[model samples]
Target: MEFLQILDSDIRPGGLIEWIPAAPGGLGAWHRDPRGTSHNHEQHLRSAHDYRRATRREGGREAWLGLAVEFDQQIDFPAVQGALLAWINRHEVLRTHVRLDGPDVARYTTDPGTVLLRRSRIGWYHDPRLLIEQIAGSFDRATTPMHWPAYRFATVARAGSFTLFFAADHSLVDGYSLVNAQYELRELYQAARERRPAALPPTGSYVDFSSSERTAADAADDRHPAVAVWREFLGGADRLPPFGILPAPPTGAGPPPAQHSHTTLLLDDDATRALTDRATALGGSLIGALLAVAALVYHRHGGCRFTTLMPRHTRHHVEFHGALGWFVALAPISVDVSDDPDFALALERTMVSLDRAREGASLPMLRLAELIGIPPEPKFVVSFMDTRGVPGAVEADAGAAVALRSHTYADDEVYVWFNRTPGGLRLHSRFPAGGDGPGEAGLAAFLNEFAHLLASIAAGG
Candidate 1:
C-alpha cells in the first residue's frame, strides 16, 4: 500500500516523483504475499508458443526485443550504467524472476538488491552499421530462463559517440513497453548525470497485473457477452483459412524445416498523409483502413472470407501506463468481403467489425480459443504501432542520443507490422521462407499489391 502511495505522487502537478523506500517489512515483504503467483492469460499464450518452438527439430529461436540509440556526442558510460541499475530498482517488472520448476510456473518481483545488471561493452567501431549489427547479433544469441530475469543491456562506444542497446524476452516487454523503457532510461540517465534523484514514480509490478487479470477472468461468467461475440466471430471453425496463394503439400518430401523472409513497403509523405486523411474522413483508424485493404487483397486472390489475428495493447489500467512488461494480446478478426463489391463498402464493413472487436479487446485470445474451440495457432497476424511522439528516435539533448528497435522470433505463417514514422509509414511483412504458405517471391508480390490497393483507397478511387 505504501508503494501505491509513492506511485500516486508520480502524476502530481509539477516536478518529478521521487521514490522513497518503504519502512522495513513494508515494500520489501510485499513479494512474500504468495509464492508462485498465477500465470496471466498472456503469459499462458506466450509460454505455449515457447513450448512449441522448443519441441521443434531446430528448436525455437530466442524471442529478442532489441532497442538501439545513437548519441551525437560522447556519453558517460558509468553514468549510463548507473541509470540502468536505478531503473531496475524502480520498476519491479525488471527485477522479477520467472519461476519454472514448480507445479505452477509464475513470475515474481523479488528483492531489488538481488537483481543483477547484465552489462557488456563493444569496443571502438568506426561504422555505425557495424556497431548496430554487432549489438543486434549479441542480442540474437542471448538467452534467458523463462523463470529468470528477462533482460540484458549493452553499450557500444567510439571516440565521440556511443549506442545503447537493450534486449529482453518477448514475454518481458511489448512494443509499447520497449519505447517506454527507453524514455525512462533517458530521464534516469540525465538524473544520474546531474547527481539529482530521478523523478520516476512507483510502478505496479507485473505480478499485481497477473493477479488482477486472474480475478477478473474468474469473476466473469462463461456465457459473458464477449464470449458470445467470440463464438459468432469464430462461427464453428476449427482453424483459420490458409493465407498462402499456393496450396500446401500434404506431406513433407524431406526434412520438416522452416525458414522466414520479409519485405518492407514505404509510403512517401504525401501518400501517407492522404491515407491518414482518408481514414479520418471514413471515421476509422489507419489500422482499420489497412485491414480493409488486406481483406480485399485476399478476396481478389480467391479467398472471400478468412480470419486474421490483430494485436491489441492490454494496458488499460492507469498504473500500467508506463509499466514495463508484455501487455499485448491478439484478437481474431474475421473479414468477409464477399458481400461488398465496392472498396468503400468493404472498408465500411471492416471498420464496423474493428469497432466491435475493440469493444471486447480486453478479452484474451487464450480464453477466446478455449471458449470457441478454435485452433490455437495463428495463421496470419496484423499489428500496428504508432510511434509519432516517442523520445528514442529524436535527439533529446545536445550530446545525448537514443534509438529503439524490436524483432520477433516466432515464425508465424504470415506476420504484417505497420509502423508510423516521421517520414510516413513503414509496412514490414514476414512469412516462412519455404513453408507451405506463400514463398518469398509470392509474399513480395502480395506486399506490392497491398501497397497499391492502399494507395488507391486513400485516393478515394
Candidate 2:
C-alpha cells in the first residue's frame, strides 16, 4: 500500500499489491533438490538477467524487449516513448523486482530498475544484400518462462525502411499473450501516428489471474474420478518403451545418428473447417483426426508402438482452466496401427485415451523424468500443447496493451517437439537447426520426407 503512491498515482480499491515482504530469493528457492534442478534454474536466471542488461546498454530500449517497429509514415518517436513511460509509471508490475531468500521467495520494489525500453530507426542501405543479414543478426536469443512486465522494445533500420522487434523475459508471458499484445500495439501505433483515438479492449492482467488460480488449485480436494481415469488408461503398463532400437555402441554403431528434425504442419481456416466436416462425417472431432494421423506417422517411422505426450489443460475440469502456470498432466498415449487400420477407430481410441489421461492428470513432467531415469539429456520428447489464443484466454488489456509470443529451448535434452499452431488444428514439429551432428543436409532431407508422409495421411490419401 505504501508503494502505491510512489509513482504519483491515486490508489484503487482493487489492484495487485507489491507485498513480497522481503522473503527468500526466487532464484535460490527450490522445491526439490537444491543442487540438481534448482541449481541449474538459478544459474539460468542470473545469466539471463546479466545478458539482458548488457544488451540494453548497447541496443537501447529495443534490446530489452526485442521489439522493432517500422512505420510507413513519419511519426514522432519521442512522443511514443513518453507515452510508454507514463504507461509504465502507472503500472506497478513494471517497477517491481523479485527478492531471493534461501528457502523463501518474495517480490519487492527497486529504484532505478535494470529493465528499460529502447528504440532505434533505420533508413537506407549501403549494400542491399547485407541489410537483411545485419538485421537478422541483430536479434537476441529468445528466453523462456515468459513474463510480460520484463519485456522491452527496440527499432532499427538498414534499408530505406525500418521495423520494430520486442525482446522480453519469457517468465511473464506466454505465446497467447504475445498475439494479443501485437494487435493492441498495432492499434495504438496507428492511433498515435494518425492522431486519432486508440480503440483498446478491457482485460484482466495475468498477474491477477495467476494469483487467483494458484489459490484455487491449492484448495481443490476431489481427485477420485481423475485418478481412476488415469489408472484405467495406464492399465498395467509400468512404462513407455523407447520408440526405436537403441543403436549399437561406437566401433560399429553409437546409436544411428540421432534422427532429429522439426517442421510445422498447418491447416488453414478453410482446411480446418473441411477437416472438421470430415471428422463429423466420421463421428470424430478435429483433434481426433489429427491424432489418428500422427499415430500413423509414428507407426511408419518407428516401425513399432510409440507413445505421444499431450498436456491436459483441464479446461473441462472445473478445477483447472484459466490457471496460471502449468497444470499440465503428461498423458502418454500409445497408438499401434497396423499397415492399414481403421482411421475412425484409431481416432476414437486416441480421444478416449487422452480424456482418461486428463481425468487422472496429477503426474507432473519432472516426476515422469525421474521415474523413467531420463538421463540429464534425452534423445527426443514428443509433446503437444493446446491452449486458447489471447482472444479467448485473457480479456485484452485496455490500460497498456498485450501481445503473445513464445521462446522455447529443448537443446540436446529434447530431440523432437510436436506442437499445435494457432492457425488451425494442424500439428507442427519444431526442431533446432544443426540438430543432426554431421551430414546435416541428409538429416534435414529425412525430416522433410517424414513430414511429407504425415501430410499425406492428414489428407486421407
Candidate 3:
C-alpha cells in the first residue's frame, strides 16, 4: 500500500528519532527547537495538586488521562504511527516537560525532536479493560523532573480490527484537548495515507498563553474584583462543606481511604429531549438544570448548602479553538436550596450563580485557594463534556468503523462527570467508598433521587 510504503522510512517503532520539520514559515516552524517556558497559572495549580497527591501512598495514580479509540477494520499501523509523530510536532504541549525549579515554581521545557514514540502490539484475545487499567496504573510510577515524555501511545490488533490507546499526564492535556488531538490525528492520518501534506493551520502555542497569563496575573492587584468575589464566596468559612450524603464520621477517625466507587445514571431519549426543552424555556442550559437538581438533592439529603468545583473551558480566544493543551479552569459554585423551594426558582438562581462565576472563570483555582486561605481541594466537583457535536466521525478509507472512548480518574471526595451521548445524558459519579461520604447504598439512593428531581424539573413541575 502507498501508506505503508510512505511509513517505511518515517515510522520508528519503539525508538527515538529527530522529528522531520514541516514547511518553514508555517505552523511547523513555530516550535522547531526546544525552549524553556514559564508555567501558566492553571498549569501551576495542576502541578501543585499533583505534588500534594504525591505525598500519599496511592495518590499519584489519578494524574493520568486515558483514551482508547477502536476501529472495526484493520488500520495502517505505520501510517498511524507517522501521524502521531506529526501531531506531536504540531503541538508544543505534547512535547513539554515540567520541572520544579523552586519550592513553588514549575518551569516547562519543550524538547522538539526528542519525543520517544514507544510502540507495542497486543494479541486478539487480550482484554481491553486490563490494558487500559495497566496503562493508567503506571502513569506516575516514575518521578517528575525527569526526561520521560509526557505521553504514551500504543496500537492493539484484534481479529482484523485495531484500537489506539493513549495515556498522558493531566498537566499536559484536558478533556477538550484530548478530543481536539483525536480529531487532528484523524485528519493527519487521512492526509498521510493520500501522500499529501496535512492542512493544519497556524495557532498560538501554550508557551505564548502561559506568558500572557503570568503577565495578567502579575498586573492584577490583591483587591481585584475577581479576588474579592472569591473571598466573598468563601464567606469566612474555615473549611468547605463535606461531600458525603450520610452523617459525618467521628472526630479522630483518620483520613478516608483514597479509593473511589463509581455509579452511573442514564436518561432515555424522550426524557433527555424533555429536559432540553425545559432548560431552553427556562433560559438556561441542561447542565445548569442538572446542577440545580444536584443542589436540591444534596440539600434534601444533607440539610445544608454546598459548594461544587465546576469546570469551565478557558479557550475563549480564537487561536485556542484548534490548539491542544490544558485550557480548563474550575469555578466554585455555591448553591443554597433553602432560599427557594420552587424548582423553577432554584434553577433560575443556579443559572444566575453560574453566570456570575463566569466573570472570574479565568482565575486559577490555586490562586483562589491562596486568596481565601482554604484547602485547595474541593469536596464536590462537577464536569461536563458534550462530544456528540464533534465535526466528523473517525472513518478510514477501508470502511472501518471508529469510536472514541474516554476515561477519567477522580481525586476528589466526590466527582460527577456528565457526557451527552447519542441516546441521552449519561452521568457518572465517583466518590470515596470508606470516607465520611455516602456509602454504596446511600450513593445509589442519591442517584435515584437526582434522576427523579431531574425528571420533575424537566416536566415543568
TM-score versus the correct structure, for each prediction = 0.79, 0.59, 0.78
lDDT of 2 by residue, 39-90 (tens): 2122334445454565443221222222223344434565455435433432
In candidate 3, what are the lDDT values of residues 263-357, reduced to their tens digit? 34367658887898888788878888888887788777654564677888877898987777667767767667765466677778788878877
Would you list the clashing residue pairs of candidate 3?
244-437
Superior by lDDT: candidate 1 or candidate 2? 1
Kindly list the per-residue Cα lDDT of model 1 for residues 1-461, writing each as its tens digit: 00011111111111111111222333344363353342343454356446657664222144556454454456776677678778777777666555544444544455776544544333555554554455445554443434243456766555575556566666667777765666688778889888999877667766677667656765666576677667677673423443453335436445334434443435755888888788878776677788888778777766677467788887787788778776766666776866545666666778877866775556565555556665666667788877657654334211232223334434445667787655467776545545555656666666778888888877766
Per-model CA lDDT versus the true structure? 0.58, 0.40, 0.57
Candidate 3 or 2, higher TM-score: 3
The parts of candidate 3 lying over 4 Å away from their true place are 1-60, 103-116, 120-133, 140-147, 199-201, 236-258, 261-265, 393-412, 435-437
Models sorted by lDDT, best on top: 1, 3, 2
Point out the higher-scoring one by TM-score: 1 or 2: 1
Number of the top-ranking candidate, with lDDT as the measure: 1
The predictions' CA RMSDs to the true structure, in order, are: 8.6, 11.6, 7.6
